[model samples]
Target chain A: MSEARLNTPISPFPSREQKQEERAARRAAVLRAAVRMFNARGFHATSLEDVATSLGISKPTIYHYLGNKDQVLLECVTIGLQQLLEAGAAARAGPGTGADRLQSFLRRYAEINMDDFGRCVIRTGEEALTPESVRRFRDLKREIDTAMRELIEEGVADGSIAPVDPRLLAFALAGALNWPARWHDPAGPQSPGELADLLVATLATGFLPR
Target chain B: MSEARLNTPISPFPSREQKQEERAARRAAVLRAAVRMFNARGFHATSLEDVATSLGISKPTIYHYLGNKDQVLLECVTIGLQQLLEAGAAARAGPGTGADRLQSFLRRYAEINMDDFGRCVIRTGEEALTPESVRRFRDLKREIDTAMRELIEEGVADGSIAPVDPRLLAFALAGALNWPARWHDPAGPQSPGELADLLVATLATGFLPR
Candidate 1:
């Protein structure tokens, strides 16, 4: 363990400032591994050793980067939520009507289903987290929900979309996007783009035969 | 463990007849406890002991009742899916216009949300099941999806609802109903009745000012 640390200081306990930078990089790497494991076996089924095994490191190495397993889960979920918000905002400038912009968001949303961030430990179970972690996740979700609601409202005001309840539509759209992670397979016939277009079409326009 | 078995007898399991019934009962009990835990902690985080302990039984007892942990998960999800299909059907009578039937289904769908069966473990993480289990769930989901699509088409044909893509509408409306599992709090401000009304209204008429 000591020799491993000496060759590659992956923790914050180095003798100098260089240690901190090394620690951050190590943490990011561990976080990446954590995302994959947690999504596969789930947060509870995954252990510190499982993570270390996947990373070709020792259990102590995990403490150096993540401190504890829970922290890794928190980081993965927090970072994912942050990315989703950014992606949603990025879609606001895309072409088409409010429905079109919303569609763009749906397309981005579909992409999340392919990998770990979309198949996250947090999104899969709220009951697994301590109240504190849940609160943190909820806070992040609330911000994104608010952003989405505003986008829906914009559609309504611009007369590009029907006047649906903004908050409801936002949540409704979110449910459709998020649901795919529970079942959609990347190797499956339906491409993400195809699913996104169909999803957006249903939400923006009603099922009423046009 | 042997002592507990004494009350039930192991002969021929002579009661092999009753044994089946008892097994069914034990299985249901395990499933109920599982739903509560899965709802609270998630399928992966919950352990076999957790299910047994909650039932005041031994771990082996659970194995006898359920083949294994995965089977329990499968059973619970299967139950949840069945309830939805049954309830959705009851909500809207068949042989009616697709729009009319779908609206009817939504009303019943909302009512089911008020029941524990509706908000069980399966709804939150059906994907947490094994591949075989997932295939079964998805196949069942497909059947329901097809029914909804047919209803959407009927609505389009009758002109009672807007003429739009029924395929897309099927998912969006279904998404709305399924989302309650993640966000709905039974003791919160809205009762199931209120929530159902809100859901039906949002899906049927939409957030549009009209």
Candidate 2:
């Protein structure tokens, strides 16, 4: 066989699954850059060109992978919410107690908010999205809120957490977790894990002396 | 003297101080409406025309009173921060321990986030602002953050609050307090004051059983 033909068989031409994996990885890279830019600059001020430029990818390549700015934002939020939902499920399924589960979930929640994808979820406003996108985003957000409230309720029922209004308590905790996305700097003195651990500890056990 | 001349002395065509008060009140009214709309529809989607229409005033009137859209947003944030600063000062000077002072300040902070001016401050991103305006806003926000940390430090020193990292604690508390601005609805089931009180209580005392 010719040298080129021999090399083709040697590389095996990358199976379809491998090709798909490569495509997914590229898409993920684009998303990471988009989220970082959107977090630094407001969604309204950021453009697809800026995201593409940051990644050294062409605008068409971005469109080919991410669709558009709105789509990119939607994907970012979707990924973040999915991660949160998964963490919630894990915490619920595997835990020492209700309070333990809630704290574990909350630590993950706070840590996520400090990441690029999580920050994008918090930073993207509904106004920037289409009505349908907004509705979907709201639904996902509601799911997360519900999961949090359910954890608190479980804790309360188990006598591990106080009988506080679950809805309000969830909002308070969620706010605290989400707020870091707006201000957390990766280059800051404290790492995301340290901040998350401190915050979760404060909530799980009151900051006031026992 | 004629009847008109005698009545003129009674009315006095409005004193300069009265006129000034009226102008100030009108300007405030314009700001109130603008902030509400900005908070509801976002600063970018909202137009002076929309605000003017909502307030039954002309666009030029909004311009005459509040300058451009950026100016209106800046003023809203400025007013909100000033109110917060004033509350911090009061809490610091008021009687009780550091915990009490911090709670008092946090209550006001949460309440402020629920109001139009306060919501505007939280909702407005600095990406839409000029460099000078962003600088001013950051300075003001930094002042508020410093005040919160100071209050927390005082509480720790006085043995009112637990020995925790004041910076992290402040971030956690501030995040919870500021979260209301993003979710609290005026027409919602609970009043802003009630919600603020409940949230502040949760953070101050925490939700775990004593």
Candidate 3:
């Protein structure tokens, strides 16, 4: 009404950037809640309603943010796989011999498997996802496997690693690290970092004497 | 009333031992069918009807033989664990150093994991079972873990295996071997024995150069 009020230029609505940020935050929160429940309970046992109830939101709100339970699980596992892929890439780009880079990637891989999204990736089976999601999940997992094999091949070429079958060696190392997802107790004495180091060390030297 | 009839040895009905044997055979067949389905489709997604239909029987027949789905799963995993336990005992009793015994046990362990009931054990999550079933499952699994730890301890004491934490080492080895249940294909190029050998060889020496 007044010239001063018109010149103030303050709006009651949130700006576009603020609205986008809020939406992203809400989506992440819903995903976090869903993944934790899925991890604690089996995927079939956990309901989207339970996730929504934990977050003080409605079931429709979850659907709006994440589409459905299957989509939520797919997203969680994808994020975990992406983190592993990024870690492999980073390790490849970074340091010493092939052995050193492989170890670095392995340590990060183990640590990620112990976290929320990472645990979901390990705990989830192919039968839990839809056909399309399972295909995507397998594709992403294969890429990670290929990256590990490449690292091992490089190490072998440089004589930093032993002349072993890279494929089998990768499976052994990944299995040793991934098992922590099933057995590692977050409340136990060893932290994720500590457990990862011990596992990687065991895989490096093995049971046989040097 | 005839003398020949009175002296006849043949009977129309089966003997008690024969009946018992038949019953046992039928029960085993049902269990095999159920475990295969559970492993392929997952515990939650698999139905008793599907298992029965595959075997050309009805659902009640499955219930009659295995009690319920939970009981069937528990039986499957329990059989797998018992096989592992028996292998451990056999290895302990066999001739050789602790390391030799441990390797013998580990090979059998990997082979059993690729079998029907053993694959079921690896695929079924604790959450898939009822509370009581889960408790029993955990107890059986704990016994296996103890057996593995004892093998590692004996090997360490005899200087056959390197000095490492028996608990962590056992976890690493068991994890590496147990993973074949998820990835090993029965129709693949390698036989279970060949694959087991490869996996154990990888673990015995590890990735690092000797």
For A1-210, candidate 1 gives per-residue lDDT tens digits of 787777874665566667778777888888888888787666767898989998899999998777788777888888778778887888786677776676677677756654577668335566666789989988988887887777777778788767666765676667767766655667888787777776665555555434
lDDT of 2 by residue, B1-210 (tens): 898887665575788999999999999998988888888788889999999998888999988988998898899899999999999999999999999899899999999999888888888888878788999999999999999999999999999999998988898998998889999989999999899999988887676777
How would you encode candidate 2's per-residue C-alpha lDDT over A9-94 as one tens digit per residue? 45667888899999999999999898888888889889999898888889999999989888988998899989988888888897
Local error of candidate 2 at B117, Å?
Answer: 0.9
Error of 3 at A52 (Å): 0.5
**Scored by CA lDDT, what does every candidate get?**
0.72, 0.88, 0.91
Candidate 3 chain B, which ten residues in sequence have the lowest lDDT sum?
A: B4-13
Question: Could you give candidate 3's per-residue lDDT for residues B80-169 as a string of tens digits?
Answer: 999988988898898888888899999999999999988888888889989998999999899889998999899999999999999999
Per-prediction TM-score = 0.72, 0.95, 0.96
When sorted by TM-score, best at the front, the candidate numbers are 3, 2, 1
Off by over 4 Å in 2: A1-8, A11-14, B5-7, B10-14
Off by over 4 Å in 1: A1-29, A88-107, A113-115, A154-161, B1-34, B41-75, B88-93, B121-139, B153-169, B204-210
Residues B115-182, candidate 1: write the lDDT tens digits.
56666633545446777887897887787787777777777777877876676677667767777767
After TM-score superposition, the amount by which residue A95's alpha carbon in candidate 3 deviates from its true location, in angstroms, is 1.7
Q: i-RMS values of the candidates, in order? A: 3.4, 1.1, 0.8
